[model samples]
Target: MTDFIKKLEKEFDTQIIRSNKHIWENYYDVDNDGNITTLYLDEIDLRDIDILLPIAHSLVNLAVLDCNIRTLITLKSFTRLEVLSLRQNNLYGSPLEHLSYLKKLKKLDLRGTNLTDTSSLGTLNSLEMLFIGGNDHLDEIKGLEDLKSLYHLDVSNSCINSIENICANENIRILNLKGTNLKKITHLEKFPNLESLNLDGTLVEKIEGLETSKNLKELFISTWRIKRIEGLENLTKLEVLDLYLNEISKIEGLDNLTNLKWLSLNSNKIAKVENLENLTNLELLLLEANEPITYFDTAFFHNLVSECYIYMRDMIDIEEIQAAAPKNVKINYDDDYRWPTSLYRAPREVFE
Candidate 1:
């Protein structure tokens, strides 16, 4: 009960709301324009803000500990707020109940919580990044249809059975649906704009509607079974393709994808190098964990062969790279950005 907080109490007492002792530790300051603003605090704990129902609108930036706060009561008062992260909290009750008031907000991280219903999400249309993943209890997510501005939608491991209804959202460039029991996906026609589609551990055996998705760049399709590269010949915009553990291996139809910079074909059975003779833009090629790659002659791939990366930390030598490269051309190899795990072992060959 400090003199300053006492003065704040007389001006803000909605049903005798009490202030937590944690609020006193915050350092308050005023700007040149006389607008009151709290710059920083050693610790951020907002379990006691209900007392000042009127000042909630003044909290332009509030980031609380994910544990202490369960359900936000007067969050709508944060009309001036922009950035908020409620990660690692219970977040019970109507998940989108209190956040609708933050119209000026930019980002919202509700990852790994018990938020079941996401029906009120469309109201916050200005949001750019929506991290609503790891909520196993969540079964319904219908309100995102109006989020025409959302760039990233990470609904990974959220128990979502069907997102066929949400396919029309064109603004989403990155859509991650990893580790779900989804066996089939229909009508990707709705998302003619999807750049990155990750179906790593699902039962998607075939890629059906991707003939129209020319903008698709990075594609991670592992687990389950995809036997052929039949439908993706027209994917000229493809940059990275990760087909780690599958059966069929003739990648002929993909010759049209000249923009392909990275290719990952590990843990499969492929005898030939296919028709990549025209893929001059290729940079990094991951062909480990498949059949014995000790046979790919480097001279065949020298036209565009930059750096041949095999089994995560190792680079195929110039002689080894020249096995797949052209004899007339010569280039250095550098294993830059890395994938931590690969079905193939690094030391089996060479690592530097």
Candidate 2:
């Protein structure tokens, strides 16, 4: 072992292995008595440290790597790293230049980093999960089309204006594009394996692009400019649907989703719960902060099963509605508080 690596081992209280012939090919601490599982180094400014090449080469078998180092210049040696997190760093240059070499990386989190270009990430074919949110300068995600193994991708709160490059990766299951400038999603039919999609806080005025997404289970289009619920009749396998904070005045075109469990239409202009009679599998329904439901129908409660709970505005009489509801169903009325109360009267045997 060299004198520099020997000093670092004693300083960090960890073992460092060094090769005499191949000095660059060395490993970190091995499992002695089950003391080390991963190498976690966060909030450390690596710019002041000089011998970073030896320290980077030592993390060969590292499974979980978390480093907030100011400069990511020496991360090329961590080839065996599986999970890497470099969030909240001061990386201004091309920090992702060496990450493409980590072939075993599965989860990567670069949230709040200064990355503007992501062209090097296309080489990481084994990456399954990636989070690049809060990057204000990232206006385009152009090089992620080859990530066929990716399943979950969160690019929320970024400046992504177009997603034309992301339509080719059909294996993605969960895609979150909240708080972007996406006005239209043109390629919904390409992702047949997509299960969950979030387009909240975008400029989407219509719901028109989902024609072949029959396997989708969860969808969130809240805070959009949609006034009607159209183009969702093909998603028969949907379970959770969130259309909150929109201009939807009616709840229509959801009768096909019989497997739906949770439906949120709160903070809309809906005046009644009319078309939800077929959602017998629905467990939770949120309709609070909307127009007052003037007509209370007992048939709505009769269609829902005993485990179903409906949350509505506080203007309705809870006791009167509970008397008319089915024996198994529960109705919770909001208390008009700033934080809405969950006060409801259910049979004591239901909780027991």
Candidate 3:
């Protein structure tokens, strides 16, 4: 390691001299030239931020999570930082414009912070993925239109009431609005490149405004007020569809979803499983907790899961459903498993 890193470690060694604290080497990632590339410190009360000035010039990723940090003025020295995560901090009154100097930053994760303003984000022109979820005080986001290159945006579990300002992010590919104040789904045509959309834990009743999301692949809307399955005829590229814990009665309007791979409709009011014979690519099907479902299309299971696997965890009537399932289809069960979006899905490939 370089002398600067040695001095940096020495300072950290003196600062956190307790036996329970780890050394500075364990909290940083170094390159071949002995330059610290990434530094991660969690749950450590960072009273002095100047201790990290030694490696700031070479650091590319920095995470000071849950450290009770109250300012961002010291991070301006990390000129090469590309990814920064200040999750679970107390930056309620910090100056967000100080981060605009990070010209190389691409992804910024600020989840579970007390930030209330985002008007200075427009200056970070290189940002591609912005995560500001779990900020209950952040009711609105500004400068979304200035983020021309932004493709992934997550504002779940916030106090935002409308999407009028969000409609300007025309390049967003994956938009997550779960557990927000959105009452209805609208302006979907504004995002022609949207792929994955989540509206779980909202008050949306009707499944409209999605006629133009033709390239959408994964859609999640659970535990809401949807009663019927409609407005899904144009999504030919759809692969995974989850609509659990709703009030859906009958299964219909799914003729164009021939490429569907996974379908989840648990805890609904459906009486029969029909109209799924065309989903030949389906590998996993979930129909648990639907108390009214009595009839199961044997032909659909014979053609769909006969050559694949399925998850039958906590199924309503496992014995009967297993009896009706094909013998070649393997059924796996889990007692306490939940979907990734139960809270909010991180920015990753949902299918894999």
Candidate 4:
């Protein structure tokens, strides 16, 4: 055995396997005092690490760190970290001051950390994805204007009322502000590359200020107080739209979205399914949990092409509608077989 391997075993107080038998075996090293440190560790699983041990500062190549602990004071030295997850930690009162020096960070997950202020994260210019959701007390994110390279940002279930700080980032594509106190949104024209936006469970009463986001493809505004479906005629590139659990009594302003594929207006006050004949690309239409439909429009069913799935309430006469509908359009009334209740359900590839 080499003298360096002996010293590592003595420092880490563990047996040393010097041979590079596995791909991951060569990246880890143990110190003489049972402290693991490595220069080649790209991803570190700190979930099972002893909290008493000093954080490994020597892992210069560490790219990912999964540390969901009570405090992250020791992680300030990980200057080369690209992805740092402090999810579900008991953090409080702006603990991100410790991570202000990590300039190369691209992804940071602080979900469920109970963080109050995130002013310290604005300096991370290279961040691409940031997940700060589930921090119920986090009301402000005013310092995120400098993140010019950000792409995806999720602040769901936070107390934020406005998103004016990061709206100017043209590189951002997906923005999630669900379960927030947002009432109005402006400066959407600055995000010319934004494709997917989520405002579910927010307090937004109007759907204006999005006339310039023509690049938007997927939009979710479920469980809000929006009564009308106007102000969306400019989104010709939209493919998936979810307005479930709203106060919409009629369906309108969707004729421009010729590329719409998946649309959900479930749990609303809609009584008619009109204005959908122009949606030639629609495949899945969800209208479940709405007022009972006493009037049947067979022409509406004929507008949908073959293999289209329409999910509605069980009270609708399926046999009568099927007799008049096209042979290929599948009308489903089974509540159990319908799409998942949540509009923001993860993509199907997550389980596969």
Candidate 5:
């Protein structure tokens, strides 16, 4: 470590030439080598390449800055960087022009940044996890036509009313769109590897085109206007389905989701739960704030014993439920027996 630090300092001195009061914003002593291993400055403006020119070949792994007035970043040559977070700053013209050089980047959080015209971002082929959730008015982000290595994308709060830009990224596993208004989505047939999707807040009237995915696991749509569950039967690998705060009265549409382990329907108009029988793998059912529960048959939900949550307003059907309940089933609204999400999944032995 000590020898490496000396090498880093010697490399830094030969590369960077300070300017504008020589105000070093920050520095790090990786191995106490009487020299700075990492350096940061305020006036290292990206508008000119002088600041970025020196650090590109140095051993810095992360670079984060705010070009409060700059229109672009001067980081076309920094290829070895691992992480970069440049958010909430202004990039009037565009900063993602030469981003393709960052092929080794793993996580890039660009939330709240004005990347409105970042048509250049489509070239960052190595970006694995990206967060553009805060750019609420970005109607379209063209050019990401070949980012096959991207895995996680968080566009939750963005105005990305469309998914047309990143449709072919087969490697994307997680997608979060928690607070965007999406009336309809097309071309989901290309996302075969998507695992988790969060559409919690939006006006999605229906989910008609999600059959192509084979490995989807978790889905969150708690605060949407959707009334029914559709386009999910083909996802035999689905495990968690959170549909809280909707108007779905009955579980009539989930007969084929036998692999689901956790299902929540709290704050809905549901009264009859007879349709829950086919969800044999289900262990948790959150039904609080629902209407009259006279149609609930314990036999239908008896298979959920190892972990379950069936709460509503009414007397307990302990006798009828006990007879059909699985021996491992445990229920509790008042105390310690309540099961966690981790326990909602049936054990390996149970599945065996």
Candidate 6:
């Protein structure tokens, strides 16, 4: 190593030793040519990044998570950086203007920051995965169509109410909008290649506007006020569905999902275990906490193509389940909680 790099290494080691952190070598990686390749300083309070500016050209992956960073001007020098994470920092007010200089940057994680604007990110054409969730002040995203190479994007738990800006990015594959202010979903036809979508903790009352997600395999709509399982007729390729903690009273609108493998309807208002006879390819089924549905239709077990796991509660009859279930099917009563407190009720027992 050169004298300058040797002196820089000594200073970095002293800082880590004084703070009682792990060995300095563990936080950074160097190439055989004495160039720094990776640096992980997550949760560290080091604020001065200019001290390492000499090796910016060699650094490829860098993470300074929760480091109280307030600026991004120094990071513009890292021209060779491909992945950068400044998650959970104090960065605010369009501080990402310098990031557009990183032409090679592909992935960025800016979660839980105090940013007010992110319009500058539209210039990152090479970006593939971008995470900007948990910024309450960020309400709108601009210039999404400019990111032709972008695929995975996350803006969950923010103030975003509309996604009109990203209606042109056809390459997007996975999108997460969980816990946002969105009450309805539109422009889904723009993402014909989407595979997974998370709308949990939103204000959407019904399942609609998903007619074009034909390739979707996984869908999550938990912890919301969705009343019925409709608008899923076009998702014939769906394999996993999680509707936990909703107001669904019936298990309809799933007949087209013949490829479903894992399904969870726990904590809903379901009153009947019907309409699932078509899901013969299911490998795991969860139906716990629906106290109203006191019985299981034994006919549903006969359609299983292979062994399946069924999550049940104590209120259901164990004798009926054991007799109705096929030899390969398995029953699970691991909900661990009893329902309807009564003085004459006896202690609970597990049936193997």
lDDT of 4 by residue, 7-60 (tens): 544654545453222233323444465444432221233343333224445332
Off by over 4 Å in 5: 1-79, 165-168, 301-306, 309-327, 335-352
Which pairs clash (backbone N, Cα, C closer than 3 Å) in model 5? 122-143, 122-144, 136-159, 305-328, 305-329
Candidate with top lDDT is 3
Model 2 RMSD, rounded to 1 decimal: 8.9
Candidate 2 local lDDT, 174-206, one digit each (tens) = 878888888987776667888988888888888
In model 4, the Cα lDDT at residue 7 comes to 55
- Cα lDDT tens digits for candidate 1, 90-122: 677635667887787766768676777777777
Model 3 C-alpha lDDT versus the unseen true structure: 0.76
The digit string of per-residue lDDT tens for model 6 on 1-352 reads 3454456447545222111223433256567786666666656555656766877889887777787777777888898988887888888654678998899988888888876666678888889888888989878766677799988888888987765544437888878788888878787888889987888777878788889999998888875598898999989999888888888888899999999988888888876788888899998887777755665677878888988987767445677777778887897775564422211111111000
lDDT of 5 by residue, 54-159 (tens): 4456534443345453543556566666666565566545647666677777667676776565456777777777777677566665555477787777776777
Reference-based TM-score, model 4? 0.76
Where model 2 places Cα greater than 4 Å from the true spot, the runs are: 1-32, 39-68, 334-352
Q: Model 6 reaches what TM-score against the true structure?
A: 0.84
Screening candidate 6 with a backbone cut-off below 3 angstroms (N, C-alpha, C), the clashing residue pairs are: none
| lDDT tens per residue, model 3, 1-352 | 3565456557545232212223442366677776777666667666545667878888887777787788788878887988888888988878888898899988898888887878788888888888888998988887768788889888888887776656346888988888898887887888899999998887788888888899999898884599999999999999888888799989898888998887888777877778887888887677666665566666777666346555544345767777877767666555575533232345552111
TM-scores of the candidates are: 0.72, 0.79, 0.85, 0.76, 0.72, 0.84
Clashes of each: 16, 0, 0, 7, 5, 0
What's model 6's lDDT at 79?
88
On the 0 to 100 scale, the lDDT of residue 167 in model 2 is 40
Better of 1 and 2 by lDDT: 2
> RMSD in angstroms, all models?
9.1, 8.9, 4.6, 6.8, 8.6, 8.2
- Look at candidate 6 and tell me the lDDT of residue 304: 89
At residue 246, candidate 3 shows an lDDT of 90
Runs of candidate 3 with Cα error greater than 4 angstroms are 1-26, 302-306, 313-328, 332-345, 348-352
